[model samples]
Target chain A: MWKKSSDRFEYLQTLVTEFQDTDIEEAKEQVLANLANFAYDPKNMEYLKQLQVTDLFLDMLTEENENFVEFGMGGLCNLSMDPECRDIILQNSGISLVTNCLSSQREETVLSAITTLMSLLTPLSRSEITHPSILHCMLRFSLSESPRLRNLAAVFLQDCCTEEQVAQAEQQMQGQQTAVGIPLPQD
Target chain B: MAAPVGNSSGCWSVPEVYKHHEQRKVCISRPKYREGRKEKAVKVYTINLESRYVMVQGVPAIGVMTELIQLCALYGVVEEYRPLDEYPAEEFTEVYLVKFQKLTSARAAKRHMDEKSFYGGVLHVCYVPEYETVEDTRLKLQDRRRYVIRTAQNRAREKEKQERSNEDPTTSDTTTTTEMTIVEYDKTCDSDNTGEAQQTSYMSHYSSFPPLPLPPQEHNFYGHTNQQGNIQTEDKMGTLHNAIINTKQQLQKSTSFSQNSSDRDRGTEQRVTPNQASAVRFVPRTAHLENRKRKMAKEATEISLTDVSGKNEPLIGPKLPEPPKLDMEDVSLNTTVSLIRNTMKQVESVPDLKPLEKKIKPRRRI
Candidate 1:
């Protein structure tokens, strides 16, 4: 079962690419294939650690923005939690392209793109700074009127900053700054 | 600026300095960069035309702006705007007709006039707004745009071209200096050797300048009159003839491009020339300046070389004079991409004789 699980990884990627523009049933096959390959396979564990997973996740960034019904925000969340995918998200230029999708029409698409961006910054210094300009652009987007945007920004701001960086920002804010969610963990 | 005062010699001696004031403005307040609000903010661009530098948009002139604005609007930034009064439908109706017309033809006169006044107002609003209100600021930050094609069509008026190089003429006449930039290009690639690029560059100058006698004269007068572009008008031989004439004129401008190239030097055109090159004023652009210059220079160099050679050979396809670089010869270039860099070899002459036909042939193949 474990050997069979890893063997299907290529098929899963193929399914994701092929059905990316397809209907709900076809997309479920893609997700199930990925979940099985990722969750059940043990012999393929080392393969799971490679940058190829990142390439696969990054490919989803270009998937039809119209197909949220197929691979929705959940797909984005699943990829974010994966370490290999997370590292790639931080390093790849395509991650910015995903974050850029936050400006997309669908709320789910926007949320997922933002979540992926925020996820990279969650484990601080895990990757080199993807882009300083993008971070500033995201912050600019966070000031938006969309409640979804506000909540995502709030969550991202809480999870993203390192303790030392936040401390400095706090000091700069002086006594007037109000507290937000979880403060950065002390090293 | 000096005001001349009559001194002992009876000739007005200008005072070098009056009440000296610094030329820079100090901004006391930053415009409200409203954050974290669905509140709209304007992106303002101020272009100091500086009498010489060209207005810049990006690729494909009008097309780039349309794409950029369309994408932005699709993503829901702010409403991308067209200039307050672009062309009235009537006059604009004939644009397709004029499109076929050579750019330098008389047909472009009206369209160029409209675009000038329209762009000037839009540029002005972008630079300054009297009111501090966001609306006022937004109005000022009209997101006005202009595109600068990589080609030579970036020149402005004819006089501007003449005046630019005419400011200094010594460097303009030298073929060695003209060859310097071209020679610097890496040779060895068949792509670079196509010899068509030179023709395009020459023709590009013509395309950019295509005689506009009206816009400079219009001076802020944009009247609305819709003419041409009806079903009957589209089929007329007269329209086609006019377009071919216009295109031919643009081609002529290409051949005579040297006459006005110095004029275009003020705007995006100068972006091509080094600052030092700008000081070398050439004659007003004329058709075939490049051909004449290249032909003349080759003749002079061959004449000098013929005396050294024992036998007389036609200058045509004569062994290329070893250019400035001696080290570059026989350096095995790694790839086709790298070969374009070795421009010191016998750089082929440009070739694109019939641009429309070439442009059309590709679509048929596709």
Candidate 2:
């Protein structure tokens, strides 16, 4: 069993190395997919951590390639549940990177980002997560057309914010309503 | 922005807080104790039993307060209903917090109404706990949501781990080694070789057959068809030859006139020209035409036989005598006797039916 795990680790190490060295988008995508698959197992967390795959995923978040962001967020979402992985992500400012992913057009990327945020939520990081802009985005997301996004945003709102804060936010929204221009006529 | 800042200040604004508190007065509201005025405290009325407040989830996007109240009224008297409108209009449909007149009704609503489909979504109805405010409920929901997500993640991870561990150690090690080697090869291979490497790797994973050799570029089009045509022609010729030989032997053995005709037809069709031995490409088309012609001839024979039989048969059959009438009275009597006997046997078998019949007959007569 130990040997099997070590072999798997070696395979993952090779993949990560290939991912870094390969300039071909397709090869990078394949390696990212494999890494993401491996990331789903908790037992592989030690190997992944040893290989510093968490940093690799974090790096992919800022890539121009949407697939990289998607697979990266997926891996982070899977690994974020692990305390060690969570700490590494947190130390690497993964919250901002993940928060940036909310604007992603890809639904899966957005979902993985949301779940990763949920997984990484700590009392200390609550302020950063509950920043006004993030809160506003989540509030809008709570009304999203997609049920998954809505429910996830609702969960974020319920879990992350207090009622007082929500009410306060609502009141702010109402007050800002009047400051904007006049309402346009509806068709 | 001004509104949020104003609302933030409104939290400290005593009158606004009071106004907000006023809306929930009919429902159970937590009382505030006077700090200094312990002596001669005024009497307060509080319902001793649990409050009739129910939190109803899964409201449809277009649902209104009245519709919710009407739906809840089926179980009990809904005193009031308020849809939580904290979310923006675009974000989510409103979820209702309903208050009933009685605790029994609230409990009944929770039991019968919970998890029922409201519109397109399932309803989640439950009594509001005494101490948990909306904020606390949200917090609890958040915690439950986290727990659920974590559990799901753990389950997925455990399943993947189990799958990995269940695999044969030797095979998995070899597979990993091969996969690593392929990845390494892919890295070292030039762009032109990358496609071939990928194809080879894919074949290695799924198939034992060696990767097929690429066709020469000059012969790409006809190369495939030439191979296919040769195999097909060889199969068709062998089958046709065997069939012809068997039919000819059968014809030599048969003494029937129709068999003789069919044998002549077969012999004419089977007469090979000088080019027939090398005419593999033309065989399939000629064979198809011969088969069709034979089918047509058989169909014509069948049609002629059917027509001759129809011409020889009469158009209508001779009339027949009517069936005898049943003796209704005798049949009814027999059935009644048999039914009574069956019932009597049933009564004898189980004596309990006798007393039941006795009570039932009296009631019927009365």
Q: Candidate 2 has which clashing residue pairs, if any? A: A143-B91, A172-B3, A172-B4
lDDT tens per residue, model 1, B77-192:
22113321222222222111111111112122323322233322211011111101221111111111001111113222232456556676543433333333223212211222
Give lDDT: candidate 2, residue A144.
Answer: 48
TM-score of chain A of 2: 0.92
Q: What lDDT would candidate 1 get against the real structure?
A: 0.30
True contacts kept of each: 0.00, 0.00
Score candidate 1 by DockQ: 0.01
Model 1: how far residue A64 lies from native, Å: 5.3
Where does candidate 1 chain B have its weakest 10-residue lDDT segment?
B44-53
Q: CA lDDT of each candidate?
A: 0.30, 0.48
Candidate 2 lDDT over residue span A76-173, tens digit each: 87677665477678877677778778878766677678778866766566666765556656665664434445556765776566666676655544
